[model samples]
Target chain A: MDFFHVLVVLLESTIRVSVPLIFAALAGLFTERAGIFDIGLEGKMLGAAFAAGAVAAVTQSVWMGLLAAILISIALSLVHGYASITQRGNQIVSGVAINFIVAGSTVILGEAWFRQGGRTPALGEGARFQTITFPYADSIREIPILGPIYSDLLSGHFILTYVAFAMVPISWWILYRTRFGLRLRAVGENPGAVDTAGISVIWMRYRAVICCGILCGFAGAYLSLAMTAGFVKGMTAGKGYIALAALIFAKWRPFNIMLACLLFGFLDALAIRLQGNPLPLIGQVPVQLMQALPYILTVILLAGFIGKAIPPKAGGVPYVKER
Target chain B: MSTPYAKLPGWAEYGLIPLVNLAVAFLVAGLVVLLVGENPLEAAYHLINGAFGRGEYLGFTLYYATTFIFTGLAVAVAFHAGLFNIGGEGQAYVGGIGVALACLWLDQTMPWFVVFPLAILGSAFFGAAWAFLPGWLQAKRGSHIVITTIMFNFIASSLMVYLLTRVLKPLGSMSPQTRTFAEGGQLPKLDWLLAIFGLDIGTAPFNVSFLLALVAAFCVWLLIWRTKLGYEMRTMGHSPSAARYAGMSESRITVITMMISGALAGMMALNPIMGEQGRMQLDFVQGAGFVGIAVALMGRSHPAGIIPAAVLFGMLYQGGAEISFEMPSISRDMIVIIQGLVILFAGALENMFRPAIARLFAMQSRRSAVVAQTKGA
Candidate 1:
């Protein structure tokens, strides 16, 4: 392959790997920006992935599968909100609890419902997301640089991938321009201030958590329905945690979150590409090390080798008006 | 509005509340079982029987408990220092490296007594070293311990895989594990100890590691409650500024607390490596380190409390294993849900019903007072 083709392939692979991460990062961005620590994002995504796969397998409709995934994710988010928000419980513990619950329930339910080694049946066309081609994709193929860029980089992506990237701009706009976004940010930093302004801190947090759930739902669906044919056990893996790291790396900003997710995505893509290829001097980097690179980098970033990451002022502290 | 239970009579606060929470958790678990179309009572019976009915099963339960005790104590120690060391899983994983190296080196020539101590030291040293970086980062750079520790877990997993496959795997062996340790590397089973108690428990994986776990617990209690460093850790946990004001260095305490926690978590390898597996392998720590969080929370971060909590989890694990075998419909994941429910109720939603319970007590007291006044009148 030529240099340009290799570059296109790498970019395409990065985008593919990044879609789920983008969704997970977006999911975390909403919740953490609203001041809720959402370590349970992994569990929620896993649960949603299983639900989507199982539902899509049964109904043979990707849309219904997406709906089921979103509904389940939202239910989990509400549970997190109830424990951490309304109940004024320990946020980390609540998130951890949600993680365990979903991790367990999904497998149990998946086994009961599908019995295919804790996986749903392989999804056929109409049940799984189909790649969408841009208009005039054939005409654009001979257009040189722009042609390959359009066809390889932009076109032939699962519809959900486009939505994942599109949601980045949408989230940025919602977080920066909208009143709900402003209130959500304020609630996270200073819920007391929001309450004094006659707004419901509870409601604002709830909305943010709901948005998180929706994004996580898409992320999970994209994993099982688009990225793969079915939900295997622990399909979300550590993407949720990686997304949280990306959130912190980006200082919880939507645009930066997108960049952070892509960076991680690129790392994963590179790992996949370099699996068997040995380099000069350094020889072949172990696949395990490559898989672990993002985490090690996250630790470095968190250690302030990059820059200080200041969380929302009132992030883990529960808001209590009476106190 | 809530004066009735005021302090909940100390016993009720610490003792009764946890019991109530566990009861509620079990109730929820039963409900889930019912939802899954199985008779909750039947499942519970099988679960309890499978865990404790046979001597061999009891041995397995104790074997599981030994690891939980170590990890739970590790988490509890961190909790006392106001740090959440979520990297126990990672610490334990790297700890396996220390275990393998120690066993491989000493097993050929040394006796079990000498090898055992060296093995324990090796595990703790490696595990503590694994945790030292994150602890140092948290202290010096203000990095969040939870996130850093979590990231370290992924790093540790990858590192272990590389080491196991490329470096440690026995030559000409396709398995991703080292050769089984020499006899000197193995810890003797506690069958004799069981016999001393008049119990005819069959020889099982339960071994001297259980005794080591018990000793570790006692030592932790002493360290936390009796030592000056423990007092410093507790002070820092309660109020860092105050600790700083009192001439306690926050950074030092944080680092030292994490090291100690890591050491405790590392000790967990003894049971799996020396007592059972007799060799180093991948993912032996499993989720025990994570489960330790729930154990510490349920145990109120006390060693005395941690023992029973650890045992309870051990029962759950062993019972769940048996359940998966007996009831193929209920996958292994169901145990995770049960564990999750217990953690949710006992830790996160711990205070959800506290005020309501307190209110009920208050109302009863008020009614009793009124009755007393009427009788006098």
Candidate 2:
């Protein structure tokens, strides 16, 4: 392949890998910005992925699967919200329980329903997400840098890829422009003040977590339908956690969260490229080294580079009625 | 109609909580069996019988307890320091690998006694080192230990997968594992000691490791309650600012607390590595480190409490594994459901039941009081 071909391949792969993370990061942004720590995002996404894939496989309708996935995700989110919000239980412990629940339950159910032993049957073409190519992109495919980048990176991805990118702007608009956004931030920063202003702190948190659920549903759908075309055991593979890291790195800003996702996505893309193909100079960087990139980046960012990425003051501290 | 039961102190509080906790634990375990459409009584019978009915099985259960004791204590120690060390998996993996490597390298050349202690110590060092980084970051840079510890778990598991498959390939097999250790690397079995207690060591794999775990637990209790450092750790756990005001370096305590936690977790490999297996392999401890959190929680995060909690888990784990073999359709995941329920109830049910019980007793006493008042009138 020519230099252009390699670049085009690289660009497309980057977009593909980055989409789920974008959704997850944005989901995390909503929850954390509202001042709730959601380490359970991974569980939510996995549960959604399994639900979506199983529904799609059985119904042979991608739309039905997507809807089911979102509903299940929201249900699980409500579980987290109820435990951490209503009961004043420890959020971290609740999240951990949810993780264990999802991990074990999905596999158990998957094996029972499909008999494939913790994996769903593959989707037929009609049931899988079809690529939505940009019209006339072929005509501009011959053009220089911007044209190649656009066609390779931006065009021809599954519909959700566009949605994932579009979400950043939408998230920014909602977080900054809307009254709900203000209330959400206020609740996160100080629920006591929000309550004093006569708003229901509980309602604001519920809404924030609901938004998180919807976004996580899309993230899970993107993983099953768009990214892998089928669900595998533990297939989300800590991307949810990585997205969480991105959200923190971005300091809870939607746009910065997107950027963080892309950076990690690029590292992942590079890792995959390096995997099976040895470099001419370094004789193939070890797969282990490549795999460690995102974690290494996360550690560095968390340690110092992103100075004072302050969590919402009320984050993870469940708001009690009397307190 | 009446106020809640007055709070008690001394042994009454200490003795009652665990008894109540165990009763609740068993009740939930029975409910799970019922949910699965099985006979609760029979299942409980089988569960107990399967775990301890056979001498070999009983030995395995105790050996399992040895692993739980170590990891549970590790989590308990961290809890005392107000740090949740979810990186126990990583610490255990690193420690396991270290011991395996030590055993492989030192077995033939070194004396049996020297090699065994060195292997255990080497593993502990590796575990402590693994935990040190996250602790240091939390102390020095204000990074959250939760995320970092989780990331480290992924790194450790990935590295382990890679090393086992590629680097540490056994003598001739392509499968993912190292060679079994030499006899010298194995933990010494006190056959005579077991004989004195009228127990056989041959089938049990019950060795010095169990005693070591008990000693470790006792030491942990002493460290938390008796030592100055323990006092500092407790203060830091309660309030970092208070600790600082009291002349404790919060950063140093954080790092040292994690190291202690890591070292305790490191000792867990002794069960699988130096026990019957005498090898490092896949699913060696099998999420015991994570389960340790539940043990710690159930035990109320104390060294003394953790022993019973560890034994409780060891029983469930043994029972669950045995059931999976017979109930092919049920899958081993029934254990996960039971575990989740245990945790849910362990954390929530106490809060729920205490009030209801107090109300029940209050009504009975109030009725008697009304009768007395009427008679007096």
Highest DockQ, which number?
Answer: 1
Candidate 1 lDDT, B1-377, residue by residue in tens = 12222556677678988989999988988887776678888888878998888878888888999999999999999999999998999999998888888999989899888899888999999889988988999999988899999999999999999999999998899888888999988999888876776766685699888998999999999999999999999999888888999999999999999999998898898889899999988889989998899899889999989999999899988888888888887766777898898889998888877887788778888999999999999
User: What would the DockQ be for model 2?
Assistant: 0.40
Alpha-carbon lDDT, every model:
0.89, 0.80
Question: What is the lDDT for B77 in model 2?
Answer: 90
Candidate 2 per-residue lDDT, tens place, B13-88, comes to: 4556545655775676566556546666766666687677665566667777888899988888988888989889
> What would the per-residue lDDT of candidate 1 be over residues A1-323, giving only the tens digit for each residue?
38788789989999998888889888988888888988898999998998899999999999999999999999999999998988878788898898998888877777777778788999998899999999998888878789999988999999999898899999999988999889888988989889999999888899999999998999999999999999998888888888888888888888888898889889898888889999669999899988998888888888888887888888887777753
Give me the runs in candidate 1 sitting further than 4 Å from their true place. B1-6, B367-377
Looking at model 1 chain B, report the run of 10 residues with the lowest lDDT sum.
B1-10
- lDDT of model 2 at residue A183? 92
